[model samples]
Target: MKRGLLFPTTLLLLLLLGTIHAQPTPDPLDGGDYAQVYARAQAGGDAVTASRAAAAMTEYRAGGRDWTARAVQAARQATTTRPGDPDAQLALGSALGLQARAGGYTLGALNTAQQARAALDRALSLAPDRPDIQAVLAEWHAGAWAKAGIFSGGNQDRARTLATAAARRAPDTLFVQAHAGIALSLIHDSQARATLTRAATLNADTPLERDLQTQAKRVLEGLKP
Candidate 1:
């Protein structure tokens, strides 16, 4: 009887250990990594990046429910965590702008873009000769100008100017080239093709760089006669 009881107890312990080991680890987002949260959200499906990016871009106007809210929260956290980091501020601004745009409020989108512009401006002020900062700022300005809706004050001339400046400042940067392509495409100029081609030739590894390159290609393709 004692031997039988010992065997059963040992079996139960072995089963419990197996169960514990078999349990799958939770995603990083669930464990409090916001960057991983964004990554997981992006990896969700079909390059969605998040439900908002997938849904809101539809032709029939899909509503952005909590997507904007989450984006805002993430942005705030990033900005707060590193007050002196321009990259953090840029991420915050980008998140806010994306959320606002997807939410479909022109004023809100413009405001968010402006906030991003301000952060970029501050970054430039702090490090005037920083190539990366200049490159990003140029992209932001060009994108802001190009994407301005009819209700917003979008000046094509200004957009072109900014894009040109960005290209000049960071001629080798993929994002700057992409932004220049977008701006030129908006103006229906032949230069867009060259810019887009140049952007594609560069190695874009980061999500942000990939996004810019993809956008540039799309814009360039759309402009083809």
Candidate 2:
């Protein structure tokens, strides 16, 4: 199958590389502004945003490590305020994945990945072509299945297929390109370079995307037996 790059974007590596996004200070609630909460969470190290960012950090690790519980609580708050907000659900799912990762055990991680997949699937069902949702899902799938046993749900073949789909879902998205590269790299095939190149070409304006691109390049350079 066709493959793509899977390097970390500059911003994502900076935040997620350490296993989570750094957070700013928590801000006063502006009457349920989930978007503001999400944005603040990205700033990192701020007192107001720190709480939320910490939570994200927890979830990204997919375990009880970091602030997994706290992240889940915060995500709950976001979803509570905006019942149908797909982003809120996505946050909740991602956080849950972190909790699962911390939980360790292959089975537990698989279960958590399954939950995340369900949540992402729901979000996609609501908006089938959403680039952000697709990109995130692609990454989630890659990570979840990377080490999974074939007997379990962690098939590299499936991961490659999903990553390719993610690339098409958001060709211009840095996350999509980065994840695609990673998936290809895992396949241990000759096409990884081209896929990694595609990820490198993605222009990531945000710190998250930038980090992904940078990581992608590193992964490309590191490709070997």
Candidate 3:
């Protein structure tokens, strides 16, 4: 079977990546704005850059494209400044993937998608034992496959394997369980329901994690029938 990359699996991926061109969400932090958030993420420490860049993804999930690409560039600069920083790599990969999805299916978007995959892969390479990276990579592979199938180098089985491991290793981590839920569902795994339920029960500390939990709950609800 063409396990890894299939068109049918892309829908959940798009759901997680969020839509582009919608009205930007007001900054979640009480008195903050997109420009200020972007600036803070850019000028912050690499770890802060990664974390805030991730919050920017929540904006994408809310359908705002305004800051996603710029956040990605800031996250990318973190990777360049600290080539071995796994967190930086993950943030860059994720932002690029979201930014590409926001761009639609143009040629440039395709190339950006490829870059996202490369960064995600690099993150895994840098931290093979990290459940967080594994969880993200699992969804990335599945999403990539959905975008271009084997041409996109996505592997559902690979996604399943990584997600299973991530779920087992980091059961309480919202990002891990939520992303694993997505990876599992894309592959039509029976565990999707359980994983998403687990994710739904977890506490969310950031807007990103909150959106992730909301996504997991929606996916779980869809599976109830």
Candidate 4:
């Protein structure tokens, strides 16, 4: 896809920030104020729920204010409870990235920007062999580059590289392929169209996978000639 055919930065921000909102039917897991429950799950010392919820929160890239804060809290708690788990780190990094994007130019955005990068760097280091981690990190880099540019540690080339690597590693995984396509399309990679097409054809086994497919299809539409 040509750079000129891409949407302007403002529009790109809206989409990448997940404001497009043209989602499919509400899934059981995504509906309601589940974020609150997820946030409070760890408060009673339920480390298992905290870990699972943190991973769940990382699935959806964006959300409303209170929901996002709660999700971030859940992820943070997960990290505190399971510091050795790469999933916990991925959750923290990915959620912080969303918080930063939603923060716009706020002072806290700067804080989250740094924390997000550090958290994701740690995640990849902890589990370099995991394609799921690679895909999530790919989206983080793409979004960081789009929102904060190179100064904030967002490298388009790195995003593309990780996305491609993830696709190669987990070609059958729904989120992996979808995120790979999303990251590639964000950087205007030539293979984005094919990757997204592959994602669109995948059988989404979970609500989150269905949601990811929706994002993939949306980006595929945008990338079409």
Predicted candidate 2 versus true structure: per-residue lDDT over 1-225, tens digit per residue: 123333445556666655643565333332233335545654542322433454534423232354666666666676666657786777777677666666667676667767767777777777776766665665566566555545435456666666777777667767667767776676564656777888898676555455557779898989984
Error of 2 at 175 (Å): 2.0
| Residue 133 displacement (Å), model 2 | 2.2
Worst 10 residues of 3 by lDDT: 26-35
The regions of model 4 sitting more than 4 angstroms off are 1-63
How close to the true structure is residue 157 of candidate 3, measured as C-alpha lDDT? 88
Clashing pairs in 3: 4-155, 4-156, 5-145
lDDT of candidates 1 onward, in order: 0.58, 0.62, 0.76, 0.76
- Candidate 3, residues 1-225: lDDT per residue as tens digits? 565566557876776567553556643342334345555655665443544444454543452665575667667678878889887888888888787777776888888888988998999999999998898889888887767778777898899999999999999888799889988887778999999999999987666567667888888888844
Question: Which should have the higher lDDT, number 1 or number 4?
Answer: 4
lDDT of 1 at 108: 65
TM-scores vs. true structure, each candidate: 0.57, 0.62, 0.76, 0.75
TM-score, prediction 3: 0.76
Candidate 1's TM-score: 0.57
Better of 1 and 3 by lDDT: 3
Give residue 209's lDDT in candidate 2 (0 to 100): 54
